[model samples]
Target chain A: MLYALMIYAEPGLDERIPQEEREGVTAEYQALLDDPRVVQAARLHPAEAATCVRVVDGRTLVSDGPFADTKEILGGLALFEADDLDEALEMAARIPAARMGGAVEVRPVVVQP
Target chain B: MLASLVGYLRDFDAAEEATQEAFTIAAERWETSGIPANPGAWLVTTARNRAIDRIRRDRTLTRKIPLLPEPEATMDEFDDPVIDTVIDHLGDTGIKDERLELIFTCCHPALPLEGQVALTLRALGGLSTADIARAFLVSEETMKRRLTRAKAKIKATGIPFAVPQADRLEQRLDAVLAVVYLIYNEGYRGRVDLGAEAIRLGQLLAVLMPEEPESRGLLALMLLHHARRRARFDGEDLVLLGDQDRTLWDLPQLEAGRAALEEAIARGGRGAYVVQAAIADLQTRDEIDWPQVAALYRRLVELTGSPVVELNRAAAVAETGDPAAALEVVDSLDLDGYLYYHSTRGELLRRLGRDDEAAAAYRRALDLATTTPERRFLTGRLEKL
Candidate 1:
């Protein structure tokens, strides 16, 4: 079971996960910590760090940044190991970060073997 | 090939046409000759000969090989990879260097990052759009579009058939290395699956950039990480660190990885890929060199700040000394969907013998785990407690 928990919440919400919502979600996530299936997690910085590149006229040039600029830059992503699509979706819904302006993208970790 | 083409004729169009023709000749001849001993020389000589012939055939044509307006440097010795390919196309048509450059150029940052690696995999990695789609979990159509868009950009930009130089080199090289490294990574350490493509790409780069340390390092990194493939999992599920059967690790790849890391360092400061390969060496050492590895990873964090790097640093710290210290670092991260965060924390807690907290971590990790192997690995850990 693997999930790419991409936090699409609005940016600049940094250090401010609304106290009530924060408490609820933190608790929910804290509970997930108790589950046996979790494998890895990661939180990303805002999208502003991105610098886009495109080649034109026998030259490779760069632009200022990402395609879309918004408050909710991809704040972070977490990877998890899971059983099936249903289980992954169920777990994704419970993500506390998702409750506060974030959307978690669940994807299976593609194993080569 | 680029170098040879330049030597053949300074004109971009002429060199390219000749190189292509040379390759056509090799592809036809190599099947019968069974690939010459020095494939590169073979390709280079053939392409050069083709260019010369083309000029000779042109009646209305040229003066003396369309000289470079200045004394053209002999293509005798240079680290430029594309040059070697053109040269190799001269004699041996057994293998073409287009596939490698296709990866390098596609990974060139001039094209958008989103599709760079995917396109490289398709053109250079030689994976089908479907195989790439399966790897990224995206649909084949999307992958195809992505590749087409990338090729269009390359066409539109007319990106030179030359290796980057000066500041521009710094900018584009990352995408190039990323393309090779990721391809090799997936190729070498395929999860639950065999990694033939990765090995193929690694060996291919080895041939293309024989003298380049990073090229060697890329292959070394794959060999090193891949050496641990068996120990990384059981027949059924993924194997977590501290739980893996270390004895099953591939000693040869690990040895090669160590040598590659040293070589990269000896080659002086390179880009991130070489740096990362150095760290992988530390991870694979008999007595893991945690502190140095931590420092190396910290440098990586400065460049990438990737959460994966953070988690890895924590693991290094935990291995080096205090599990609690590692847990503190882990707690500070914003990681949520990542499984290693919880799993690493859980292992630390379990080592401390805090059964409840460890169980909590295992549970959290399981909930987040996406693959069957990961689930099984986490569940097995849970049961052990």
Candidate 2:
């Protein structure tokens, strides 16, 4: 089963991260992608740039910004194909995105019949 | 030795900088001279001599005379003739700092009780913010803020480093004892570098209030409790008091406890710590001193009027004579938020052969436990019952 792992990064971490440190983090992300079970992964821009897209009765509506504003923001996400939630969560935990004051939210993805 | 020595002679910030500078110099020079026989002693002597050189070269002391308090009698400044004196002064005993004055300063009751204990642990106990947070069972951010507020209050109030005066000292005695007791407890836990820090705190308080009953009581409490620490746990987990090996108890610590108890007895007025220590001493005795332990508990009840004291008294009272009497006392206590009281009361019930009631109490304790270890331990006891 594939799980969508959401990365929550503490505020202003991107600006604080040096170029060299950023490259190291990117390399870590690349290593995760190399694992065949990782079907999809992307480091999102700051939540402010996000446009929430939802489809109701085949009518798609786009919102101006992200879902919430808090002390932290949803910075990135990944999709992992694993046999169980625990296995998916293990992969999510090792993701560089989840380290350095970030938490990963693991949600199992459902496929349409 | 140099880092610690500099840290002592000068203030924290300056001493740290001087140590760094000395290390940098040593690193550069060592390629030629090779390593010294004793790196620490050589570093200390070099740092001191270097510090003196800088001081004489600066020639700024005369200018700052109005601002800087006159320094301590400079006991033989480091020169070829005075090297022996300097080394003696810098020896382990001289600079151990004891942290006595600092503990008293931090534990002043002008700060709230929580602040007094927390600040003393932070400043003198050498506890990190996260470590304090864990010990207090509070969030790290909350602990950081509390520490910051306490430090700001110190800076704003300009609280003198010297111990408080006569009337206030007597007024604040309880607070001091509480801080010392907490330090001792942390040391007894054996995690955290509390040995040097907390022992130093205890030794400091014991010296500061040589005649105070509770102070001696606090020392006796620590020595007695620490005596069992080696035997308290088996491998990673609590061995439970009934299961602990009596042979492993430290005879030296027990002797020290007896000496402290004598001092506390000689001094007369007592508090809860004295009572607790007396009970622990009784428990460790070859023959239980039931009557004395019960009397101390009764005195503690009079001092604090706390139901917790009544609960403890119940245990000693039962051990002395009637389990029935002890059960009644334990049954009367209303410790709604406390988990241990219920568990303890249950154990007392079991000893008196009230199996069903003991099982119920164990269940209640299991439900109330906050940690996985405590929950597991209580549940295991409940299952067996």
Candidate 3:
């Protein structure tokens, strides 16, 4: 099964980390992406830089920030190929953001044949 | 049969619908043709076929086509040789493993606790949705939605239909045992015969995981409680264990319970369930050992770190000819809102000849009591004071 591990974190959460621990945190995330099960991974730009776009009737509606105003914002995402949700969850739990005042949503990806 | 179907289909809702369809067909055809020699295998084969047909027709389930077993060359109805071949393919042991897998999947910790309980009862206990709803004091529609949402989450989250690996097995098994115990407690409170259903599930677990002594312990614990079910009450009034009629107890069931507890002990099991079973077994002895019971309660308090267990320990301490110390221990704990705490306090105070305080404590217990018999007992205590 394919799962999308969407990492949600408070804005500027990385900034709060001690300078000495920053490299270790980065290394942890790097280790996660290095896993063979990780099909694709990407760290997103801060939610503030995100542009939301929607086509309404005949006009296009654009927003300056994320689509939802929430305390936690989408920080990163990884697509994983795992046997089941439990395996995907194990990877999700390893995401540094998950233990650092953030959450990882383990969503099963829809398979298309 | 449903378990095997779920194993083959890998979709709970699809398997349930297919099983239902197969049973309906069997009910109509069995009357004229008489029952099949192997009714269970027949139902499983029919359900697998129905599920495969439904999945084939549904375009969105195209990805699941690969998971289905190879179809028979000819999909003829009631082909005895084909059924025999399929049954042979799924040996008897395979069916048993499938049921175990189904149980582990149903009671997975990833699911909500209520979902675990509901799904276990529905799938393993073979309770209808309506019956489960009634037992849980919910409307049929609410129960339906709960089951639907749970099943959907199981599919969407890709919860595997297999026993957890050794690393995760202990924690997962604890969740399963807790759900069964919760069902038994619900029935113990006089909801329905969910206690019987839980015992059946416990028996299945003990058989499936013979090496796991906790399974035997849980089976023992439930059987011990169930053996005393008839002696638990006299008409509508709650009969205290000491006052319960000995003849009303199921002696054979108690023996079975004791034997299960012995097996658990022989396996060197001292987990929460096993300890609890030992405590229960001690309680049923001809001569009660208050000091030993208190020691077990103390151990249980350490193991559970629960205030409720501490309260029980206090009760046992009182039985050891130290009501004053027991009362002091009860007062130290923050259980003012608990009915049993007040009742225990009242009893201790009455023993210490503090009638006025005991009456006040009884009033508090009376206010907190929810059951008729409990209220009556509290009132009687107050009257005596």
The predicted structure with the larger TM-score, 2 or 3, is: 3
- Clash pairs detected, candidate 3: none
Worst 10 residues of 2 chain A by lDDT: A83-92
**Model 2 CA deviation exceeding 4 Å by range:** A1-113, B1-98, B128-141, B165-170, B189-197, B352-357, B367-376
* CA lDDT for candidate 1: 0.68
**lDDT per residue (tens digit) for residues A47-84 in model 2:** 67888899999999899877786666888788888765
User: What TM-score against the true chain A does chain A of each candidate get?
Assistant: 0.67, 0.78, 0.97
Backbone clashes (count) for model 1:
81
Candidate 1 residue lDDT tens string, B1-385: 7775786588788888877887888899999978999988888888888877887878335443444253322222221344335445634656654555445566765568868887666555556677777667678777777766665555434444544444344455556766766666555434323254565566765565555666666666667777788887678676665577878987876787777667766876464667677877767666777889888888888878788898888888887878888888888998876777888888889878898999999999999876687788899899999
lDDT tens digits, residues A23-113, model 1?
7766776787667776766666566777788789989998876667765666666676654444555567777657666677655554422
Q: Looking at candidate 2, what is the lDDT of residue B96?
A: 48
DockQ of each: 0.01, 0.01, 0.42
Q: How high is the TM-score of chain B in model 3? A: 0.66
TM-score of 2: 0.54
Where does candidate 2 clash, by residue pair? none
- Kindly indicate the candidate among 2 and 3 with the higher lDDT: 3
Residues B30-103 of candidate 2: C-alpha lDDT, one tens digit per residue:
87999989888777777767676666765665555556653432222211122223334433773645355566
Candidate 3, after superposition: displacement of residue B27 in Å?
A: 49
Give each model's whole-structure lDDT.
0.68, 0.71, 0.83
Model 1 / residue B353 / CA error / Å: 4.3
The whole-model C-alpha lDDT of candidate 2 against the native structure comes to: 0.71
